[model samples]
Target: MLRQNLQQKLLQKLSPQQIQFIKLLQVPTVALDTRIKEELEENPALEDPSLMTADEPVSEYDDLNERDDYDSEAKEDTSTDEFNVEDYLQDDNTNDYSTSYNNGDDDEEKKETPIAIESTFFESLQEQLDLVPLSDTDFIVGKQIIGSLDDDGYLRRPITSMIDDLAFSQNVIVEEEDVHEMLKVIQSFDPPGIAASDLQECLTLQLKRKDVNNPIIKKAISIVEHHLDEFTRKHYDKLEKSVGLNSEELKEVVAEILRLNPKPGDSNQVTTKQLQIIPDFHISNNDGILILTLNSKNAPELRVSRSYMDMFDHYDKAAQKDKKLKEAVQFVKQKLDSAKWFIDAIKQRQQTLLKTMNAIMHYQYEYFLTADERKMRPMILKDIADKIGMDISTVSRVANSKYVQTEFGTFLLKSFFSEAIQTENGEEVSNKEVKKILEDCIGNEDKRRPLADEKLTEILKERGYNIARRTVAKYREQMNIPVARLRKEL
Candidate 1:
């Protein structure tokens, strides 16, 4: 014999409508229009306000007022409750719903213009290669070498592997010497560093193209060729001893080396078509007060079709009840419900976006007003989420892809959030402030003797910012600034 025990539990889950709103909230303004267009195409019951006439009535089935007869027949046949057509035919006019913003702008005038295309880096190289004078085998080998180059214009593949490729793929047996000759020809192409195999080679190629008679140019080339390791490590003493140059002369050589392009292929790299960023919110500073406005393009005029509403009402009053008529009514009800749910989701998305952004704007109010990044306070997603009474995930979704235009400049919303760091006075400040101070210190330090992380930490402590040497190094790396040794000059 088996016994069963009674157990009860409660569970929470998101409905379809809630999930829909969450997805829409994460979509940026630039892509929201396309999303709405897709919904309009899929749902026949949905319609744009511009497509409907002004004088059109909300419902055509209003004349079919037979509620009393339908009720009495429902009572006689209790099974009719299983298919209650009256529930869907209620007098709710979704036609009155408008998705347009109050600012009044025509929807037909907004459109995206096509962008022009440009030639890629490889295509330009191939065109240049066509003009070179070479025999058929040499031309094929040269083309193979060019194809092996990466986006940075460096030939990362080994010559031995390329030789194998030529023998198997092209049915041509070529020696390492022949490949090297072709590579030399490619290195002499338009871009000074186009076919260099490494950073040292790239820099040497560029420096060789400069005035050969200049002592500084020759010294620079020698430094890149022989003393490259010492130069990179900022071992100025070693470089001066090896190159036989005085302090002032080494400075000139260092300056010349710094001017050469380390990555030559970057100059001819194909440019990508930049996407236009349409800010979702605009914050204007007026008389020291910041006012936020949502972008008008986000709000499009949308409505449920009046004809669909009228057809549902007509089916409800039909004297002859049939299977086909019931199916048709059910289909119309689904479409209508979906249309209403979508409109509601859009409204909810707008509200959530505004609420989250407003909280962030006010939280960083001082920074926005003065355009001083130092004024920004320590803030995180949790801070805004708590203020707006929403989940942290919701706040993150809103901040991740959204852009805002301010009196200062257009910035990504996510850039405003930063982790907190405590000062010597037990006060909390944004890490951005610490980074800004570090940037200034690095910028003003004597290039002859750059400050190391330990010294940087001491300086920061003197200014009331209590941070460790490791943390200072972390922040410096985040800013893409090299270590003191690499930053050292003459």
Candidate 2:
């Protein structure tokens, strides 16, 4: 014998529409257009309203509740394993698939902007290599060496490893001397230090390209080749004693070395092809009031296809209904439902973005108005979430990738949120203010005797910040500032 127990429990789950809305809400303005285009391609029933003619009649089943009777009847009749084609033959114009929103008369037509293409870094190098006269084997070996260069233009792989690669991959047997000669030729290519193995080689290669008769260039080469360690540690006195140079001559030698590129490949790097930032919101200070406007490019006008609705209407009134026709009508209905859900989700995403950003704008109103980062108040994701009556995760999704343009500058929304720190007077201030103070202190200190974390802590305490030495070090590292020892200069 077996016994069963009865229990009741509650569960929560996201509906398909809710999940879709969440994904759309997280997409920033720059990517929303591409997402919409993908949706358009995937669903034929979905269309851009601007592409439809002005005479296209509006859809009849625009309201979602209009299909309740047909849906209920379909659900009731579809329970059996067999289907009767005659069941859907009756004329039902009101049950046709349609969209909820109509195209506005004032909506302007959208046009796509074309992007220009540019050659990549490797392509430019290959072009230069073509001009070099060499045997086929030498050329292949040279190509392999160029291919082995990292984005920083350094050949990190060992010569022995490359020799094996050439023999195994290219079926070419060559000695270390051949590879070295080809490397020397490549290093002579444009952009002074194209195939250097390390920073020292890179600097030396560039100095050799300059006039060798110049005494300063020769001295700089000697310093880089010999006293590089001492020069890096700013052991200038040791370098002067070793190189037999006076103080003024040592300065000139150091200056020449500093002018050479440590990472030569960075100069030819194609950074101009980077994607431009598209700000999600624009905030303007009109006299004393701050106005927020979402970028219109994000919110596209989408609607159900009028021809699909008309076809569904025509099929509903057909006297001789077939299995194929019923299947076609069902497909149309499904597509129409998807289009309506997508349009609704886009609208909800717009509302949520505005709500979250409005709360942030007001929360940091003082900083935005004054264009002074120190004026920013202490705020966290929860504070805005509570203000706008949404979950912290929802607020975080909006802030993570979104940007806002103000009179001061365009800034990432997440950058405005900082933890609170109490001052000596028991007043709460943004940790950003403390970081700014620390940065100022380090910038003004005599680099010959840079301030340590303990000294920084004392300075903050004198200014009523009451911060600790460890906290000061943490903030300094967060700002990418090195320790006192690394910051010292001669």
TM-score top scorer: 1
lDDT comparing candidate 1 with the true structure: 0.83
Clash counts per candidate, in order, are: 0, 0
Q: Where is the poorest 10-residue window by lDDT in model 1? A: 95-104
TM-score of each: 0.84, 0.83
**Worst ten-residue run, lDDT, model 2?**
94-103
Model 1, range 98-147, lDDT digits (tens) per residue? Answer: 43334335553366666557667788888888999999999999899889
Write down the RMSD of all candidates, one decimal each: 4.5, 6.1
Best candidate, lDDT-wise? 1
lDDT of each: 0.83, 0.81
